[model samples]
Target chain A: MKTRVIVTLKSGVLDPQGKAVHHALTGLGFDGVNDVRIGKIVELDLADGTSEAQIDEMCRKLLANTVIENYRIEQA
Target chain B: MKSAVIVFPGSNCDRDLAVAFRDVTGKDAAMVWHGESTLPDGIDVIGIPGGFSYGDYLRSGAMAARSPVMRAVAEAAARGVAVIGVCNGFQVLTEAGMLPGALMRNATLNFVCRDVDLTVANSQTMFTSQYADGQSIRIPVAHHDGNFSADEATLDRLEGEGRVAFRYAGNVNGAARNIAGIVNDAGNVLGLMPHPERMTSDAHGGTDGRRIFEGLFSALA
Candidate 1:
């Protein structure tokens, strides 16, 4: 089985890279761009019978920093 | 005071940190390799120097944080040893779960390298005792992932408890509340983006960084 972990910075946390991208978009004459936030997508290939709790532990322990980012796991 | 400077494969600042430890503590610091799971006995201070540890693979400091030696470092920290991590070292500390928050890429997506002003937010920390409260000092920072972020409640608690040790005096990295360094809940660990070891001598055009190690030695002595 394969799993995907999506990690994103928490709201209210300043995303400078996102802000710079937003600025560049506006500079290029693209309007209506309210905001931009950056994140990470991590995919894992696990053996059969990998439990959801184990994947959740992976995200909490290493894939994402719980202090500043939130992560969700999805089966593919 | 006996001390140790953790050395990873890509840690270029280990010697400099070792020098700082010797200069301040009057004792040569042990250059502990990353593969060793044990630090020298009775070590009082541990310096995690900056560099592109493991070439910033996966994430900055991610690989280095999980290295075998970090287990020993974590053990020492839990025993109330003073630990100061600088720049990439800060990232490692966070990844190792020694400090809170993750250091992401700079908001500008550029490597920042220069002397920037920083405010001493909490002078009571073992590392910041040489600085006065609210004092502004210049220190050099060289990193692409110095932008600090944390959840709002955690940030509030860090602020309320006076755990924040330093704040950028200007727009350096777009850090939250302009935080430059912070102390852990037990106050024995500090993780900062600025490089105090790089500025500890007059040959480096500044001595502002000297007080930090000096203060640490004095307090720990």
Candidate 2:
């Protein structure tokens, strides 16, 4: 099985990199962009019978920093 | 006093931290690698130096925080042992959950590298004992993700408890309330983005950073 984890900076945490990209996009003549934020996607291929709990623990333990970011696990 | 400096693979300032330990204490600081599960005996101070640990992979200090040696560092920190994390080390400590808050990318989105004025917030802690209350000192900070962020309640609790150690005199990074360094609730663990070890000697442009090392030993010894 393959799993995808989406890690994003929690709301209210300042995302400087995201803001910079937003600025660049506006400069490039793109409008109507209200805000911008950045996150990461981590893909993992696990063996059979890997539980969602285990993946959640992985996200909590290492994949994402809970202080500033949140992670969602997606399995396919 | 005995000391140990943790050395991760990408830790470039490990030697500088070790040298600072030796310069201050007149004894060699053991360079404990990340793979080691246990530290040397009778370690009074543990220094986690700056640099891109684990190449800042997954997140700054994330992988290094979960390494074998950090487990020992955390155990020692829990036992009242003094632990100081500088620059990248600060990130590691926060990621390890030994300290509150996290260092984010600088608000300017640029790496800040220079000497800046810092005001000692808490002169009573062992980490800041060498300085007077609200004294201003200059130290060098070189980092990209030095901006510190935390929730409102945690920030209030940190201030109410007088855990904020050093605050920047100016807005070098977009740190909350200009906080430059902070001590854990127990007051033994300190995480700051500035490199005190780098400014420990006069030849390093000033000896303002020397007092931090001196302060730690005077309290412990």
Candidate with the greatest TM-score versus the true structure:
2
Tell me, by lDDT, which candidate is best.
2
Kindly report which residue pairs in candidate 2 clash with one another.
none
Quote the lDDT for A53 in model 2: 94
Report clash pairs, candidate 1: none
Mark the regions of model 1 whose C-alpha exceeds 4 Å error after superposition.
A22-35
lDDT of 2 by residue, A1-76 (tens): 9999999999999999999999999999999999999999999999989999999999999999999999999987
Backbone clashes in candidate 2 total: 0
Query: Residue B107 lDDT in model 2?
Result: 98
Enumerate the candidates' DockQ scores in order: 0.57, 0.89
Chain A fold similarity by TM-score, each prediction? 0.95, 0.98
TM-score, cand. 2 vs. native: 0.99
Stretches of candidate 2 off by over 4 Å are none
Interface RMSD of candidate 1, in Å, is 1.9
